[model samples]
Target: MSHILEWKTRLYLFEEDGTTKARATLDTGTTTLTGHGAAHRNPADTDVPEIGDELAAGRALRDLGSQLLDIAERDVESVGARSGERTDPVLGWSL
Candidate 1:
């Protein structure tokens, strides 16, 4: 089965009031899913824009990944119910 498809995702980050915020959006043509995250700078800590950006972006992407997995799990259950929790055969771990 050749299912040649492409999904595009866009991530945006911004800093405001000593906080760095990030938004990750996945565009699948039919619908869009978004995840948000933020990192706050402590008043006593050193100000590092890069660190904040990295943290915020990583968190946003992590959130987005979780949402994507939930969608897949739901879709799988809709068409054909699973006897039990899904697991990766090779890894022998729960999915």
Candidate 2:
């Protein structure tokens, strides 16, 4: 048997000057994680657009990784409970 889960997350990025730079949407489905990047350029600084894209995309991916780890930890706990094994929330699985 296989377990499948889907989660949606959005990240908003702002420039150092307090201006909106980019927005990212992350779709984590089953066994895949996908991201969409959008840029809001500031005519004053062309570099800001690229920076925004990088930050937004990176942040979205980091968030996805956190979610995946959380799911794995929960699954480990479930298995350990069924087998009368003790699992440490901090150190993870124990045999």
Give the whole-model CA lDDT for all candidates, comma-separated: 0.85, 0.56
Off by over 4 Å in 2: 1-47, 81-95
What would the per-residue lDDT of candidate 2 be over residues 10-94, giving only the tens digit for each residue? 6665565523344455566545544333345556766645666676667566666666666666776676643333344334455
Model 1 lDDT on a 0 to 1 scale: 0.85
**Candidate 2 has what TM-score?**
0.43
Query: RMSD of each candidate?
Result: 3.0, 8.0
lDDT top scorer: 1
Model 2: colliding residue pairs: none
Most accurate candidate by TM-score: 1
Compared with the true structure, model 1 gives a TM-score of 0.85
Candidate 2 CA-lDDT value: 0.56
Q: Once superposed on the true structure, which residue ranges of model 1 sit more than 4 Å away at CA?
A: 83-94
Error of 2 at 62 (Å): 0.4
TM-scores for all candidates? Answer: 0.85, 0.43
